[model samples]
Target: MTARKRLFFMQLAGLILAFLVLEWLAGVFTARASLPYALSLLAYILPTLPLFGIIPLSLNYTNNNPDLPLSAHRMAPVRRYMVRMGVSMFFYVIILMASIVALDRFELSVQIKALLAVLTALPIGGIIWAVSRLIADPDVDEFERMIMTRSVMASAALTFFFAAIWGFLENFAEAPDFPLYLVVVVYFGLFGLVQPFVRRGFR
Candidate 1:
C-alpha cells in the first residue's frame, strides 16, 4: 500500500483499538467509575484535535503577529466566516429558547417534542450548507473532489460505527446511554477531522 493509504488505515486501526480498550474499561469498572469515564471522554476529544486546524482560520485568528497588518483584521473572507457563524448561532439560540419554553410551559407529547427538535435542526443544516458553499473552492479539480468524497464517506462510516457500538453497549451491556445531542457533537467533530486527510496520497 501507498504511504498515505497506510497512514489512513493505521489511524483507523488506532481508533478501533482505542474503542475496544475503552469498551473493556467500561465493562470492567462499575458505572460510577470516574477514571474510565474520563479516559473514554479523552479518547473522543483527542482524535478531533486536528479539527481545530481544519476550520476557517481558527488557529491564527487568535494569535497576535507583529508583521501582520491591521487590514488582515478586516479581510472579507474572515468577515464572511464570522458572519456565517454569528447568523447560525443566533438562529440556533432562538430555536433552543423556543424548545425550552415549549417543554417547560406545555405538556407536550414525545412525538411533538421530537418534531420540534427536528424542525429546529433543519435550519441548522441549511446554515451549514450555506457556509460551506461560501467557503468551498469554486474550481476544485476532479481528483480533489474524489478525495474529499472519500473523506466524507470515511467520516460518516466512523460516526455510525461508533454510534451503533455505543448504542448496543448501552442497551445490552448495561453501559450508560449518553444523550443523543452529546453523541452528535462527537460525530460532528469526527466529520471535521476528515478534511485534513483529504487528497493525501491520492495522487
Candidate 2:
C-alpha cells in the first residue's frame, strides 16, 4: 500500500483499538467507582485523537490516489474543505471537553448550561458550513460536486431512515433512547461511507 493509504488504515486501526480498550476499562470499573475527572476526561478523549489523524490522512489518500482520477482543478476545494473540517473538529473537541468539565465540576445556572449546549452545537455548524462551501464553490469540478452532493443525499436519507425506525422502536419496543445530536455524527459517517461506492459507480 502507499504510505498515505497505510497511514489511514493504521490510524483507523488505532481508533478501533482505543475504543475497545476504553470499553473494556469501563466494563472493568464499577458504576460506583470514582475516577479522577482528568483521568476520566483523558479516557473520553483518547480514542478521538486517532480520528483527528485519520481525517486528513483519508482525505489526502483519496485525493492523491491514481484510481480516483480527480481533476487538478478540484484539488484546491478539497484541500480547503479539509482545512475547514479539521479546524471545526479541533474546536469541537475543545468546546465539548470544556462544556463537559464545566457541567461536571460546577453547578451552573440554567442560562449558563443553555449557553454551553449552544457552544457544543456550534462546531457542528462549522462542519455544515464547510460542506456547503465545498458544494457551492465555483472552482469545484462538476464530477466532484456531483459526488459530494449524492453522498450527502444518501447520508441524509439513511440517517432519517435510521432515526425514524429507532424512534418507533424506542416508543413501542423499549429500545434505548438515541440522542438526536448523534444523528449529525451518523450522517457524516454515512457521507464518508457512501463516497467510494458513488465514485466507483461514476467511474
Query: What TM-scores do the predictions have?
Result: 0.48, 0.77
Q: Write the per-residue lDDT of candidate 2 for residues 59-148, one digit (tens) a residue.
A: 767777876777777677878888999999888987887688668868899999999999999999999999999999999888778999
Among these predictions, the greatest lDDT belongs to 2
lDDT of each: 0.57, 0.82
Alpha carbon deviation, residue 126, candidate 1 (Å): 1.9
Segments of candidate 2 deviating more than 4 angstroms? 1-7, 15-50, 69-72
The TM-score of candidate 2 is 0.77
* Regions of model 1 farther than 4 Å from truth: 1-85, 108-115, 131-148, 197-203
Model 1 agreement with the true structure over 71-141: per-residue lDDT tens digits: 54434444565566556655664565466545755798999999988876766775566445544634433
